[model samples]
Each structure stands twice: as C-alpha cells, then as structure tokens.
Target: MNTIVDFQQFNNATLEQVRTRFEEEFGVMTYFMNPAPRPCFNKICMSELHQSQTSLEKMQGEVIANGKVSQANYLVLASDIPGIFNLGGDLSVFGDLIRAKARDHLLAYAKLCVNNVWTFYNMQAPVTTISLVQGQAMGGGFEAALAAHIMVAEKSALMGLPEVLFNLFPGMGALSFLSRKIGMPAAEKMVRSGKIYTGEELYQLGVVDVLAEDGQGQYALNNWIKKNHRSLNSFQAINRAKQRVNPLTIEELYDITEIWVDAALRLDERNLKVMERLVRAQNSKVNSDVAHIQEKQSA
Candidate 1:
C-alpha cells in the first residue's frame, strides 16, 4: 500500500503563508513558514497548517513510485522570515475577540491551534517531523516548536512564553509538550516565570534536542541527518516509544484550551491594554521590516 505524495502542488500552488522545498536527494520536504503581517500563527497560518498536513498524509507509506524509492523520511519545519520564527497568536484578533466577549470564537481559534499543532506532534505518517528554530518563537509559536518530534534550535534563537505578560497563559500545547520534554515542575516554572531563554539555555535544560550555532541551523540539521542516516529507523522508533510511555492526547489539549478561553474572556480592560500595546509593537516592527525588504528589492 503506497500513497505517492504529490509535491508539485506545494511547488506551484498559491500558498501565501508557507513555502515548500523538496530535497529529493535526501527524501526531505521542508516547509518554510512565513505568516504575513507579523510572522505569527494567524488565520492564514491555520489554513496553511491544514494544507501541510494534507501533503504529509499523502506521504504515508510512500515507498516506491515510478520505479524509484522516493519515500520522504524527514519533514523539516522552518521559518522563511529572518530573526522571527513566530510571535505566537494574533494578538490583535485576541484583543478584539476578548473585548467582544466572543468565547465561542476564541475557543474555536484555540481548538484550531490545538488540532494543527497536534498534527505536527503526531504526524501519523512514517516520516519524522522536525522543527528548525532560527529565531524568536514566543507563546504559541514556542508551543508549536515544542510539538515537533525533533527540535533543533540555533544557539542564539530566543524563545519564551509571554502569555502571562498580558494576564493569560499558553494554553495550546505548551504544558503538555514541555512537561514531556523537560518535566512538569520545570514546565510550570517556565509558564509562570514569563522568561525568555536562549537556545543554549534550553539545550542545557534538556528541552532542545539539538543546538546549532547562530545562522547555521540548516547546516546543523543536515549534519545531524547525515550522522543519523543509517540509524534513522532507531531514532524515529525511540521517539515513538517515548510517546507510548507518556502520551499527550488531543483531549488534554482541548481541556487546557477551555481553561485558557475562560481566562481570556475574564480579562479586564487593563489586561487588554497590555495586549494592545504588544500588538502595536508587532505591527510597527513588521511594517518596518516589510519596508526595508521592499527598499532592498527596488534598490
């Protein structure tokens, strides 16, 4: 039973938030995330998540097609934007929804996040999933990175859970993933501390699988792949065994999300004000970057 993955769609399809590159030589399919406006997990990224899953599903049991063993063994998730992996959720949307007292909308959004991140955590495909963090990955973004089977981060990359700053919590999959990677006590401390940590610090804490030098994230991952090429089966199997020993079910994610939505709905004006400020900062930075990129292109 073989389902041949069609990479042509990713090559030419009108995907706005993600750019796909198929490394045929290594059975690798890397998707570069570039969620626009702020590089956050916005609505567009949600849709793109589904698209990526669809492609991955097609890669299941993909052994040989057209007389070639083109089975994709690794799927690496990367960021197309420099200096920013993702800033987390759409704060602007959060402010608006919270103000409107839209619990259902907020819950829906959180569930969408849970569903998507869960796929990255448990791809269901034979291929191993990797998160290559090159820059800042905050809140939900950090949670997403934690969901990967392998998290390879650049030593200089900055990551944190800043939900507490605005009187909230990272409710998607942070606690679940972090608890499994490190421990509950450490994960709880991280969630409550609201601290930003460098990739080196995370590697020391055993949260990061592999730590690479600054600006050499891809190189590090390539080297790791080569080193483990012969033992990829054992590597992937170990990841699966770890999950069996301590599983993280989608039901638990949904339960946590409900708590998050309740807390979000209860936020006062002051809390929203804090979120608004962050949103403004994100907008200003993104606009400035866009302008700079445009200037460079035209020059």
Candidate 2:
C-alpha cells in the first residue's frame, strides 16, 4: 500500500488492460485509473483507510497534471472494496494521536484529509467529479462522497456520519458540504443522530444525487453522464456560481478542524473506550471480509 503506482502508465491502455493494472495495484489501499466510456477517466479507490487520504493527496496531484494536458470531462470516484465503499477515518490513528496529546499530528492528518476533500469539492479541474458508492460509506467516507459534484449510490448502500457515537463530529468537510446539499438543520441532525441511512433514504433527503439498483452503481453513473452530457457546461457553471455565492473555503475547513482537535482532546476514558470498541468492529469487519474472499478463491 505504501508503494505508489503510476496511473499515467495505463492511460492509453485497453479496458481489459486497465482492469489488469487496477488489480495489480490492489493492496491494503490503492487507486487505479481507467478510461471511462465517455470522454473522461475514472479513479477507483480500493483501500482500507477510507479513501486513503494520504494517497489521495498524491493522486489528486497527478489528476491535476493530467487534466492540464488532456482535460477530462468527468472524474469518477468508485470503490473496489465490495460491500463497503469506505468505513471512514482511521479511528486507530485518531485514538493514538488523541491519547498522546499530539495536537500537531492530529492537525496535520486533518489538513491532509481536508486537502483531499477540498480538491473533490472544488473539482480542481474543469472535469465534473462523481462519487459512485456501492456499499457502506460511513463518517469521513460519507464526507468524501459529499465532496463530489455528483453522488451515485446503490439502493442498498448505507451512508452515515457515525462520529457522534465516539463523541466526535465529521469535521473534515461534512458539515460544510452537507449543509450545502441538504439544509443546515437536516445536516446538523444527520451529524448528531449517529444513524446509518440507506441510499434511497439519502436520495430522498437530497444527500444522494442518484440511486441505482443494487450492483448497478456504475451503470447509473454512466447513464447520468450521458444524460447530462449536453448540459454539462451549464451544470458546471451553475455549480461554480453556487460556490461563489456560498463558498466553503480551506480556511473554514481548517478552523473547523481546530475545533475538532479541541473536541477530540476532551474525550474521557469512557469515550475512548467506545472508540476502541468501534475500532475493533472495523477490524473485525475487515478480517471477516478477507476470510470470505479467501474462501471464495479456494473454492
């Protein structure tokens, strides 16, 4: 997972070749580039660290570079992880940093996260950004999805900000983005509720842009792109206008992170224990998934 794969190498490859490259890059967390059916490219996330924010920072740079040379019409973010788009921020890292009172380290990580999310939120290039969520997208995962210009989720996919359970809130860009997507009141309720929602529910709530049948997320995404192709310019312009009117600046995100850091530091032993339990739950889910994959391969 530490090794960075050069995405440009497969830029001109055939669909099958791109698929092979994607599989080869698969590790604990990785991203692979694939040419979309349309005049665009896709960046698929296959990671354990909830979009692997560090790697995302690296990938985002490459994306910008590529866009400069050959502008992509769209930038789709999809997950290779089955039944789980992402679980969210690395709680284990948070717990350790909080226990050590490493405010600088926490802030650095938070900033890295914000940088990645902000890039998606702003669509660093002229391309339209899309998040295709096929499964569960929790906490920071949900925040990442919201960062996209369009969020396409499968009907059965689960999405939520469960940070409240650990006495924390999704401070990266959830509040700002969610408030923009859904009203501030609903956004506040979602952040404070600690409840998981189905894609259909989120779609109805205006949090999810498109809802597809189970296992049809990619299809839905492509359909949306095709349907909106003629109006892409106008759509993007409107989005930019929206941003101009109600900006979510990096400064705002950083300010919120400071508050998050302060809040994280205030967690009592009981709260820490609750976080520990969630960490265990995350690990257990991953382990079980690995086991299931191994069993299938053996069969």
Candidate 3:
C-alpha cells in the first residue's frame, strides 16, 4: 500500500497520445501526454483524452468503493515526449482540411477538444488536477496545461499561444482559464501578442501557480502535493467556491472554439502557408526527439 503503483495496473489504458502512472503513496494519478506521429494534438490524441478520462473514472470508482471521495486527491498531467510538452493542434491536418473546405471536420475536432478540456477543468471527482510543465507548451498545449486546477512548471519552460501567427487564435479554454487567473484584458493581450512566456514570466503573471528550478518540475509537483494534501479538503472547498463565483461553462468554451474553427476556415492562402511551415517545424522536432532517444539507447 505504501508503494507507488501505476493506474495502468488496474486499467491498462493504451498510450498513443498519453501514458498513465499512479503513485499510490499520494493517490496521485498522472497522465504523461506524448502525442504520437508528430508530437502534436492529432485525432489519436483527442481520442486518447477520452481513454484517459475513462481510465480515471474507473480508478475513482475502485477507490470510492469504500464511499470515500477524497481517496484520490490528485491527478497530474505531464509529458513523456522529451523537451516538448506539446506543439499544439495538428497543423498538417488543419491545413489539409481547411484547403478542402472541411468545416465539419474542423468543428468536430474543436468540439472534442473543448469537451475534454472542460472535463479536466471540472472533474466530477473530489480531486485536485495539476499540470507539470518541464518543457515547451505551445498553443493548444499551453491551453491544455491551463485546463488543470494547478500548474507546477520549471522556470525555464516556454509556453504560449502562437495561433495568431497563422491568423487564428487558441479557442480551447485558454481565454476562459487565463481570464480566471489574470484579468480578461491581460488574457486578450497575451492571445494577441503571441508572445512565448517563460515559466518564470507566467509565474510572475500569476498564471503558473508553482515554479521550480530547471529539471526539477516533478520534484516541485511532489513537494507541492506533500504541502497541500494535509489541507486538501479545505483547499478543494476553496477551489469549488472559486468555481461557483467565477464559473466556466462547457457552452462558453464550445462557442469560442467554434469561432476559432470558423476563423481557421476563413484563413487566406498566405495564412495556410504559415501553418504548413509550423507543421514542418513540428515534424523536425519529433524527428529530432526520436533520433535523440535512439542515440541514447544505442549509447
């Protein structure tokens, strides 16, 4: 019972976009996202979101069989992909679909993303969700991290929304969550500016809840868990209260994401070209990460 066991031990959730690990010592379940094919949010990653949700629900049911809701006090999100949390949406797919004028496909993708984000932000279980950012979290990636109740980031981590670079915007709960942290005006400025904020900067901006030294993100997350678990009940109550006072609804995220899909559909050829370049850059990173892993294994 004192040993850390993976949730996969109970429910063998497949890992295409994400992997699962649980520390029974702290009752913390972590989903380490590693979006496959190109380290970006693709269809597989979206489906994996549901897979993760189901896995967590099952875990919750198992632990709550004793009628204790606080048994699972934390769910953490991290990344298995080296040096990159996520590069955001699958730009290649977006470009191809946009060029084909596939509004339905785009809307479908957006809706799925919003739904998952909403679930993470509003988990039904009495658990505190966290994001541990040790690498780059761009566009939808940053939004994904923001979806958590708390974010523990390495100070050197880089994060931002670069959708504006392609004449679009991050529509999946970025503004809603960010506005909750730092006013609406600041959120709007961040979205428009497309500036890549370091973890330290975001901590200063009140976006990052906990900041750790470089390469110590996981350590910081555990330290935080230790510090907060004693007061978990009260803290959770405060979090719930905040939700009541400044609520974020699924409908709100859906509406904004729909607008993003429409804007993407409206992008000129010039904008599509930018997205294409971004995809290429993402591919390069994936390739580099693979090679690095291979080199290490060989060595």
Residues 62-133 of candidate 2: C-alpha lDDT, one tens digit per residue: 332312322345655666567877677777778888999999988888877777678778755455777888
lDDT of 1 at 242: 92
Tens-digit lDDT track of model 3 for 127-171: 788989988999888998999999999999999999899889899
Query: Over all chains combined, what TM-score does candidate 2 have?
Result: 0.80
For model 1, where is the 10-residue window of minimal lDDT? 1-10
**C-alpha lDDT values of all predictions:** 0.86, 0.70, 0.83
- List runs of model 3 lying over 4 Å from the truth: 1-13, 58-70
Residue 52 of model 2, lDDT score = 33
lDDT of 1 by residue, 175-262 (tens): 9999998899999999999999999999999989999999999999999888887898898889889999999889999999999999
